[model samples]
Target: MNDNLAVLRGYFDAMKAGGPPAAMPFYAEDVVLEVPGAHPAAGIYRGHAGVGEFGATMARLTGGTFRLVPEDLLAGEEHVVTVATASANGVSWRRLILSTVRDGKLATVRFFEGDQALVDQVLSA
Candidate 1:
């Protein structure tokens, strides 16, 4: 793993261990986070305020117990692709997260759930 990818992984690990605050420093001021069923962070989030809110929302939704267990991570010059399992609420789902890094911080993150049926079941329950 490159230095930037290592840092990004560390940030994700921090989020898994604690909450967003642990990973706050790894995000740029203008970070964009896209998740399913949410638009608060779809576009651009300027400064820590937006990043903080995005983290808070994630923590709330996952009951602050979300973890990303990376199966594979491929790092390019400007992007990193992570395949991991996100587990919470007594359920585990596989997801692919594509992240773009700018100046050693995360600029944008897009998540793709590989199994829709499993995701649907988890969401519906």
Candidate 2:
């Protein structure tokens, strides 16, 4: 695999193994994470601390049940698109992650859910 793809794969592997804290090392110092929805965790998270809060908030809101299982990764020169299943509290939905890598680090990530309302309902509960 290419370096960028490898980097993303490593990040995802870290996440799967140990959650956000384990994945933090793959993120750039000024990384930005954009999460879409009307739920509490839906917002733009900047830097390591913000990303940590985002993960913590989601975990808290979901009672630590939220999980992501990656199914595919498509890479380009500047970005990688990840297709995954996101689940919490027995509800599951397809999630698309658009990620950008800069200088071998994850610089930005924007999440797109297949069913926004379903995700909102699950998290809001």
Candidate 3:
């Protein structure tokens, strides 16, 4: 893993271990998180308020745990691809997130959930 990828992974690992507060260090002031069917987060989350809201929602729906486990790490000129497993809600889903990093911070993250059927079943259960 390159420096940026390592940093990004560290950020995600922190989220998995300690929730939002631990993940705050990896985001920029103008971070943009694009989760499907949800509004975008377009600014700095100084605390865990915004991030917590998002996590709580997911937790409620999943009834298990949701995490981003990077399978493939690819660094490009300004972006990276992190193929991860989003397991929770009694289901395991695979997804790919394309993120653009600027100044060592995450500027934008575009996530594509791969198994819509499984995700729907879990969320609707």
Candidate 4:
């Protein structure tokens, strides 16, 4: 397996083990987190602090039911993509996340939701 894939896997493992906080080690200090939508959680989050806030806000907007469980990791030269599911309100919204890694730490993340309606329902409700 590529080191990037392993790192990505570890990142997901961290999330499962300790939620967002545990995943911090895999992210750069100035990482960019982006969630595009009309939902309250949608926006650009910068740096470690911003990423932490991103996780919290997403959880709050989803009524504390939001979680991303990665099922697969695909790696490129400097980018990794995770196939994951965002679960909330007993619904699983499949998703694709493109993560840019620099010097073994995540620098930027862009997430694409497979079912926007499900996400909106979870966030808006």
Top TM-score prediction, candidate number? 2
**lDDT (tens digit, per residue) of candidate 3 on 1-125:** 57678767787788778877788878777676766632322222332345566566666765646655777777876887888887774567788988888898887777787976656666666
The RMSD (Cα, Å) of candidate 1 is 3.3
**What lDDT does model 4 reach?**
0.86
Candidate 4 residue-wise lDDT, 4-116, digit = tens: 88889888889878877898999999899988777888899999999989888877776787667778889988999999877987888899999998888899999899987
Judged by TM-score relative to the true structure, which candidate is superior, 1 or 4?
A: 4
Q: Go through the candidates in order and give the clash count of each.
A: 1, 0, 1, 0
Q: Each model's C-alpha lDDT?
A: 0.73, 0.92, 0.69, 0.86
lDDT of 3: 0.69
Tell me the lDDT of model 3 at 113. 78
Which window of ten consecutive residues has the lowest lDDT sum in model 3?
38-47
**In model 1, what lDDT does residue 115 have?**
71
**What's the ranking of the predictions by TM-score, best on top?**
2, 4, 3, 1
Please identify which of the two predictions, 1 or 4, would achieve the higher lDDT against the true structure. 4
In candidate 1, the residue pairs with backbone N, CA or C atoms under 3 Å apart (3 or more residues apart, or in different chains) clash, namely 29-47
The sequence of per-residue lDDT tens digits that candidate 2 reaches over residues 5-114 is 99989998898788778989999999999999998899999999999999899889999988888999988899988999999988899999999999999899999999
Over all chains combined, what TM-score does candidate 4 have? Answer: 0.93
- Give the runs in model 1 whose Cα sits over 4 Å from its true position: 16-18, 37-47
